[model samples]
Target chain A: MSLTLETNLEDPDAIYEKLIAMLESHEPEKALRASARLVLLLINHIGDRKVIDEAIERAALLTEA
Target chain B: MNVETGKAAWRETIPVWRAFEPSPKPETEFEQARVVIVGTGPVGLAMAIDLGQRGHEVIVLGRFDFVPAGSKAICFSKRSLDILDRLGCGEQAVEKGVSWNIGKVFWKDRSDPVYKFDLLPVKNQKMPGFINIQQYHMEDILLDRLKQLPNVQIRWGHEVTALDTSEESAIMSVDCADGAYRIETEWLIACDGNKSSVRDLMGLDFEGRIFEDNFLIADVKMKEDRPSERWFWFDPPFNPGQSVLLHKQPDDVWRIDFQLGWNIDREACIKPENVNPLVRAMLGDDVEFEEEWYSVYTFQCRRMQHFWHGRVIFAGDSAHLVSPFGARGCNGGFADIDNLGWKLDLVLEGKAPFDILESYDSEAIVTADENILNSTRSTDFLTPKSDISRAFRDAVLDLAEDHPFARALVNSGRLSTAISYPDSSLSTADADVWSGGIAPGSPALDAPLDNGWLLEKLGGRFVLLTTTPFADLPSGLDVLDIAQEPANGLLRERYDLQGGGAYLIRPDQYVAARFRQPTGAAIADALARAMGEQA
Candidate 1:
């Protein structure tokens, strides 16, 4: 199976709000570290190397834009 | 919900303090004792009771005249209750204490728990998973038990002012209300707490981490009938960005802990005015309650490098300290007493070599290290040091609501459990191939029998538990043949006994060895090794 690129969250806006609230709770340095940790945690939760690699590539491409 | 003003109502209900009266001075300038325990805390009193029950004359010195107030250690684990049962006060403790096995964890602003756990998944055991009773009540129960033992003498207002130790004995100069006197003993055990005077006299210091975070403990009395369970919240709406823990204690007293960050006015924070609002926020404005007791504390996880110091020994908080999150402090101390009691008794009776005391040091260290590691991890999880750590913690909580994997990562506290001494030199290695059961160096698991429980029959002496009977056995070793019992199915299942299986249990109720089929010589050798005898 490939990475689910489409919107899969039950409540995307609520998830976004939670993510934002989490980031706002900490300082910038901590927020960056937290984001890094969150990415790692999400990757581990995914637990598929190919899917994680594809998701990383897609994220990188989006960032480049 | 009605809110009451003023703290007088609840404060009046606090236990009254009894004045200290000094014991009569000894006839001789230097009194000799068989066993002397310094400190009248639960550990000291329990140690005295264990020794006194073994027919050893025990002298316990206490600096205080009365039972100390404050609900210091409210959570007593199952293992601790089992030890209390052996000491003869488990019934009173469980009866007066609120027993619970369920713990619920809540995330931010959520009324429902994201994760729930049952501490005692395997039921039918004699003791519950945990009990919440005031520390003073526990001390009183132990004190009452100690008074019942004629061999024990409790000397209140006796303080150890000076100490000297030789290879064979420890001499302490104690200061009482009258004056100073000296007592010499073959063995001196220190059960003094964190600021241990005995530890100070010995110039021993603990080496571990001191957490910077401070926590406010408020014990309040309310008429509300809450479920008897541990409730922990992370970043709750009432206490934003901080953690909160609530437990149901006996009477109407509820223990509520609020995590206050490193910097704060310690004195001002404990004031009723400052603490009341926080309590009100959690219980709502209408809920009626009165503050019973309040205190702020900072925890440390540390231990002395060695607990056995020649003739002077250390147990409980004097030897080690841990974050209270796991309830390991007093429970670990009980473990120390449980390990040392029987070994010390044997040594005193000339049945075992003095080298056996070294095993107590090594085994108790194992428990201390295990408790410290668990509590330290719990503290770190509760109070993340770095942003990334906090993010990971929050992420785990965020996902915990829906994902089981994330729920496993959340740790409010590990809670306390009995630790097995897998690497002790005393336990004989298993020679048989066993699939599942209690192993050597592990505490014996309890199960119900025909008339009573399993643990009630096993402590204070070496006993051989077997499914098959033997014609002749070694002296001093008693046998409990399960085949003779009417309802022994659960006992057989717990010990994995199909037929002809046997277990050699130590005096402390720990497994010394187990065999599928045993011989007299093998049992004798295992018993000898457990007593620290040379091959």
Candidate 2:
């Protein structure tokens, strides 16, 4: 029932693999909708404002550059 | 049981019930048959007709002299009807049964349907989404069809007392009215239903969880003008805080099920005095009706570890049992016989090795597991095992009334559909770049034609269907040209016939292999692998 934010990136790596597999199985529009819902679920589960802000900032920085 | 004339709609429209005639047997030590099928239920009769049509000598043994009462397993799916169509009884069943394609679900204190689903969205298939008919009517059609096949012999009032099986053959001791006799056969099929004597004699047990809930099913005769659609309610006004299900059958008979808790007395619940109030509450106070039959029952989602045991094979209720919520009981059994009929025929004729029959065992186990999984999930969703589960289910139902996302989470029952055997050893692994078409180990998608549906032509043989013109065919393989004018456009679109693709279809009308580019060598290799040859 606790988040492991200080750990290594193993958990995120596995989640990324599963997300990619899900995207590959669906069509383009369905994959897009599913990605949005996945983000919503993860944010609701985390339920921490500072952690969410930091995660969003890090994702923006990594993907935009 | 005889019904009084001119009193009820069922009495006028329903066919006159007839009992199976007992035939005289020769005073001999033993009789021989190629296949001895125990039990003449829908599964047994269907198997007998399938094997008999293939020129195999079939002997079917039935313990009962007449068809069982009540309308059991009323929902027949499109896949089951297609399988029955190949057996020459599908059209008659559709003609005599009530057809329904739409389902509506209502929650507690709700006037509108919370969720609605259309089972068949298109009208191009050979059969409807599903049909509602009494099991006795379907059995009558199958038994009548069995008479057309001269190779099938059915013996009523003959029960199996004992059985002995080995690697080569099986011998069964049958007790008839006159005396006991022995029947030796190359193969024995145990379709003897849930409490199979064959399975007992073999000391095999089903391994799964038993549910702790009970249900009372009642069939009533009344004149009502409701459409032939499935209606389900969760915590309805009549039965507060419990689930109820309703289905329409032929002759204006309705099948209603009331969910009773585990601790209630089953005997007390089945009494007329207790059941009458529930029936009255379901219908309005003014509606009058007479109860035809009633029963109290419990379900368990269980299956055998394997479908085939040496020379004696098991199918139908003997092989697996599932909750009735999803209509998987008889429908799953039809799938079993469809998978077994061809393989047993091939092995018996020496056209294929006995290892091919093992694929029947494996594939049926996979399909039975799928049915068990779905039925168990539905049962859990309907009758939650814990309080937290119930709260989550109620939340889903509450959200489903307005939000579209929560609608998918609501599960009254997932109606039976044809299962695809994606992991079967008989299927060729897909290597081509096709993304969204019916691939290997998938049921063939049907389309319209000039004279009939596409499946009607492809079934009962090993066919090679190609859109482009093809010259020489491999031995024993039939070619079906998709460019036959009227159906070419839809067939091409549905089957992905672009670039002139070729598909290898099995006798059961399932896609075994598909190639983006047509070739003789590739088709032969895939066909050989499908027949259980080592790669």
Candidate 3:
């Protein structure tokens, strides 16, 4: 299965704001760890290995610029 | 020259320095020129040669009388060589320089490279992937070409003390060795390097990050039988907990760079007594070599908010700077002039509107940003910031030894290449669809033709490359019909002309527009758009 690029979120703006707020609440190191944990949780929730791997690749490519 | 004096020891082996001769006073108190370029570096010289070849009068002002000594900016990228070829000196540079297409990176004390890659995977191009030539040698070649063009005047020992600009022209007060004078010109270009006086006079400054590390560049003359290639090491035994880069140059000179941590004695590190030991450690005691040049540089990736300010423009180091890791410093500068020369020429000739110059500013900034991003990433990879980062880097290296996927993650300075201006306003959006070829706003790819090369035929003017002949084409646009030349399958393959196509290339050899089938109106519209005319 191909990774979905277009947002399927009910409220992308709210979800993005919530994610940013979550990242802002912790110290720099703790924030990194928190994000890692959040990513794992979301990966497990998605559960399809191919889609998750594609998402990971897309995320890595996005960080380039 | 005696070797006893530590300061002048390197000069004995390197190019001789000529004394500065002040230019004679202008016939009139206030001289007028069509174009005035500040700085005599490679970018400025290339700009002069281009304008001179176009039969435009150019005045180049340089603060220095002689070309500076040093093996600075050794790697000239293929795109830069292509630009130099258009200016009439590409072959000389390639002949006098060491050409390399392969780079080997080693991690830890591995006897063999953990990662080996080819810069030019697809060969048979006009120029090599990169040529390692001393900056002074490149400058000399350009200066010789400049002397041949009588329209271009090189004024040595002339420094811009101040600059004043208006909508139509720029006036600068220049102080030469003989005396001071003022120059009024239609266009003024600044190529005076990073610590540019022109940028200061205009109250402009670069905005970006400066890497917190120092690299010691040691150019040495040695007689070694090793093949010419780039060798980079991470945490090598010679310099543990650091990185080292080795590159071969002409005249048996090798450029060896050793990365020193942020906090160190800068002056003490360049001393021969201290530097020789590092060289001995890297190249065993059996090899004999003499020092050619020693420099310790801390690189920064920065550029101005805008490359142009009114009638006065900035190019090369004066406009943007990047870490030397990716060989982007001089190559980026050459790309700047390659973008600007044609635009400025058209503006001076009244052939194009003034707004066309703005495209140069935008397109060049795109190139600068690309160079900065790539060099910054390379710097981050070479010098990991934290413990976790270092661990991650080591893990990637470890995996790279056995896995090709991990090798792809290696970022030992993504060697410089031509940057594509895909978002340029001058480029006409594609109306025709194709599978794969050079898209609009990309530099033309070089290929072998029956005669010379594809790039040689395309440079210095707007050209139309078509597989089928056109009965009515624009007056100024020259056509290069594939059917006229002897068969070269690479041209058709590279341009994806299997189904037949056409491309309108800009003066700098960038694809302005491409079409599956030609229409006179579409070609004219694309040409006008590329010239920044109202479409």
Candidate 4:
């Protein structure tokens, strides 16, 4: 087995709308849990640690700013 | 298909009610029995038949004269069917029930299924993965089998009002239609349901979480050609924006459950005017249907602190209650049926000490906890009390439509499977190194045999299932040789046997111990431990 990125979401707009609808009413704790699950799911889908680390660095930079 | 639009006809066709015939009154003030079971529902009746067939004087007390109305618990698992088979009603249940294994999960605003899974991923087994037979039919079949046993006595309308437990026995006051009566028994088995009178009389409190979600189940008789599979919708474009569950049942009837939120008039939701529109939306406008039955229920994952209280033992819904998502309500009760009977019989017969009965308490709690955990998870996914949880659930389903990893996260309902007791107190630790065999304390995995299935031969007695022949054996152990008859190398591969091995199987078809080589002394020791003897 090897690490590879899968362009799985053909319709990202619809999925994004669903994600927004999901987080619409969630509090901070719930949002954090949902974010973790979402990140884990994307990480699992990506299956590449290096790619995940780079994305984490980019996210951390935004948070630091 | 003739779809008559009116009241449910299934109620009309329920064959002439076989009311329990009361036995001749004894001259004694209180009738005595080796075991007195309360409630003649599936759990109580199954236990009565098991103990009765084993030559125990068993008496069952039921409050109602007729079987309860409606399709209460419809999903019968493979393990439950095996237990029913031991009680001699497996074949009938299979013949009359709608069998299914595949289940599909669909999300809101999407037509295609997010994922589908097979419940029974193996072949050459005796029973199907699961069957969708109404609970009433199951009770009728079990009651019919109970009648065949001469030693089993069933008294309808004999409601147990109070219970007094003693050091030696327990006495129960029964309120009959005529007057009041009393009965004394060495052991009392309470299968009385969730609102158990026995538990209330004993002042035992049921403790657990009560979910703030309600589900409305509608059994509708309609004419449609759908695959015999479970179809669940997380947020389909139907009645509510929540979840919906649909299953194909026998007699052209289908069970539909709509997840109603906490704030609603439950009494108003089950009305035909309210429910008919929901069914029409799911089935579309063309399908003609008639309402069979309906009920509203909230989920609760709760159980008693101890299933065994002195001489009186609680089983089934009386001991525990689970969210109906997993079909564990009745199926889990069947697990209790498999665990309690032989231990009770042994203790009553003086063959095994009474402390062995405590194993039933520990084991039932383990099973209840397992069921509660799974049901809670499924309920959380299905209902998602917290907003973040709902979003996570939604994200999983949305991603499941494309990503394979996300599909595994989707939990509609695990659907009942046999809960394995890998840490039972009765099992013997593996003394010898072995591979691929069922571990001690696990339910005996089924493999095809030459003439029949493995489980069909391993029921109703303490069995010494060996591939190699033994010379001197423990007293009262039946020997089943799988050596001569191997079906497609399955038996060898499943048991993970190199040359040959021996398995001490309890009467419930659970593996008590396994050994690499056959020694009579070792086998007897395993048997003694399995019967709850101190080392």
lDDT winner: 1
> Candidate 1 chain B: worst 10 consecutive residues by lDDT?
B1-10
Estimate, for each residue in B395-501, the C-alpha lDDT of model 1 and write its tens digit. 77877888787777789999999899999889999999887778999999998989888889886789999988996678979998888888888888888886559
User: Interface Cα RMSD for all candidates?
Assistant: 3.2, 10.8, 7.6, 3.3
Poorly placed runs, candidate 1 (over 4 Å) = A1-65, B1-20
> Compared to the true structure, candidate 4 yields what TM-score?
0.88
Question: What is the C-alpha local distance difference test score of candidate 1?
Answer: 0.89
| Candidate 4 clashes between residue pairs 3 or more apart in a chain or in different chains | none
Report the C-alpha lDDT of model 1 over A1-65, residue by residue, as the tens digit: 89986878899999999999998898887777668557757777798989999987888899978
So what's the TM-score on candidate 1? 0.89
- Kindly list the per-residue Cα lDDT of model 2 for residues B1-535, writing each as its tens digit: 1233313243343333566566556468698778999988899999998898998988899876667766477889999999999989899999999999999999986879999998888678989999999888899999899989988988876778898887778998987666789988999999999999999988898999899899999888899888889999999988888899999998888999999878999889989999989999989888888897787889999999998988889999999999999899999999999999988988888888889988899889888999999999999999989865676677677667876767887899888988999987888877788856688888888888888888898877788888776665678888898776465667777887766788899888889998887788888888888888878
Rank ordering of all candidates by lDDT, starting from the highest: 1, 3, 2, 4
Clashing pairs in 3: none
User: Would you list the C-alpha lDDT of every candidate in the order shown?
Assistant: 0.89, 0.85, 0.88, 0.85
Question: First chain TM-score in every candidate?
Answer: 0.91, 0.69, 0.86, 0.64
Model 3, stretches more than 4 Å misplaced? A1-65, B1-16
Clashing residue pairs in candidate 1 (N, C-alpha, C atoms within 3 angstroms): none
The numbered model that scores best in TM-score is 1
DockQ of each: 0.15, 0.04, 0.06, 0.17
Model 2 error, position B419 (Å)? 0.4
